[model samples]
Target: MKRSKLKWYGAKSELIELTKALIENGNLKGKQEDIFNEIQEVFNIELNNIDQAITKFNTRNQENETKFLDTLKNTLSKYIKSKLEKNR
Candidate 1:
């Protein structure tokens, strides 16, 4: 059977929370480009470059992460968690 794209309830909110947490923890410093690359690499999403990645993320209003995309999200989330822990 074919699988459908994952439908999340509060993906956008979660993204916001994740962003805020990363910022508050200063985990967002010096890794902007690497973060964008991680998103593309983990999601198999092709973005032109770091700026495009930032633009895409900034332009999104409210969006849900599909199954494959969720994999990317989780990967990033783990990265943030690790960073937060490491810095503490």
Candidate 2:
């Protein structure tokens, strides 16, 4: 499948915020203890410049989305991909 190249500014920031909310609200279900940390690791890159940050976030989000979809079960992956489609 061909991946779309549209970019969303502050998506990493949005991801971090949503992940934080899920953790704080205990909204994530079973085996989610380290999931936020995993997302954090993806956000930890040193984007010293604004352009760098934007580029890095876009690149990482694309990579992470690919991996996330690959790991999801058949029934759930489409749901996730659907949510992502709105942002693009």
Candidate 3:
């Protein structure tokens, strides 16, 4: 697949978190490392030391740990609400 010009500016830990969620929810199928490798390939970014990154992410305060995912949830909720309102 062609690599996108878009780059992931968020922390690698955020990607790791998303990857884990996808796998756990059965949205994605594969070992975490393999899925992460595909993500890196698609984004054309290298994420080294994933184990260390995950460790650091887990050690963060509760509110901070899933910051990116929380933001994603909020953003998607707003978008859906806006669409629903537009159709009402």
Candidate 4:
């Protein structure tokens, strides 16, 4: 899909605030529809900027996911090894 060009002035700032809100809230507490509506309300004017922000957010999210999984795997491996040694 073709991305709309971002509106520079207030749009970028609004998008930044929206991004921060999402990150801080993480699992936004509300009905899915309401949450979506809120997002739409915020980004409706600056749809293009929203697209750009989403792309960046997705990239960061993937990186964070990889780091989290790696940490979890290492922790589990150590825990399993300790248990096995104790059982032996």
Quantify all predictions' global Cα lDDT against the true fold. 0.53, 0.50, 0.83, 0.54
Cα lDDT of model 3 by residue, 1-88, tens digit: 5658878888777787787778779999978889888888877788888788777767889888877789999999999999999999
Residue pairs in candidate 4 whose N, alpha carbon or C atoms collide under 3 angstroms: none
lDDT of 2 by residue, 14-65 (tens): 5544554465588775554466545444555322233343344457765564
In model 2, the Cα lDDT at residue 67 comes to: 40
Query: lDDT, candidate 1, residue 78?
Result: 100
Clashing pairs in 2: none
Model 1: lDDT equals 0.53
Screening candidate 3 with a backbone cut-off below 3 angstroms (N, C-alpha, C), the clashing residue pairs are none
* TM-score head-to-head 2 vs 4, winner: 4
Q: Which ten residues in a row have the lowest lDDT in candidate 4?
A: 1-10
Per-candidate RMSD, Å: 12.5, 14.4, 2.2, 13.9
Model 1, span 1-88: residue lDDT tens? 3444444343443443344346448977656556654544544444454444434555655553233346667999999999999999
Model 3 misplaced regions, further than 4 Å: 1-6
Question: Which is the better candidate, 1 or 4, if ranked by TM-score?
Answer: 4
Q: Where is model 4 more than 4 Å wrong at Cα? A: 1-65
Per-prediction TM-score: 0.28, 0.27, 0.76, 0.31
- Look at candidate 1 and tell me the lDDT of residue 69: 49
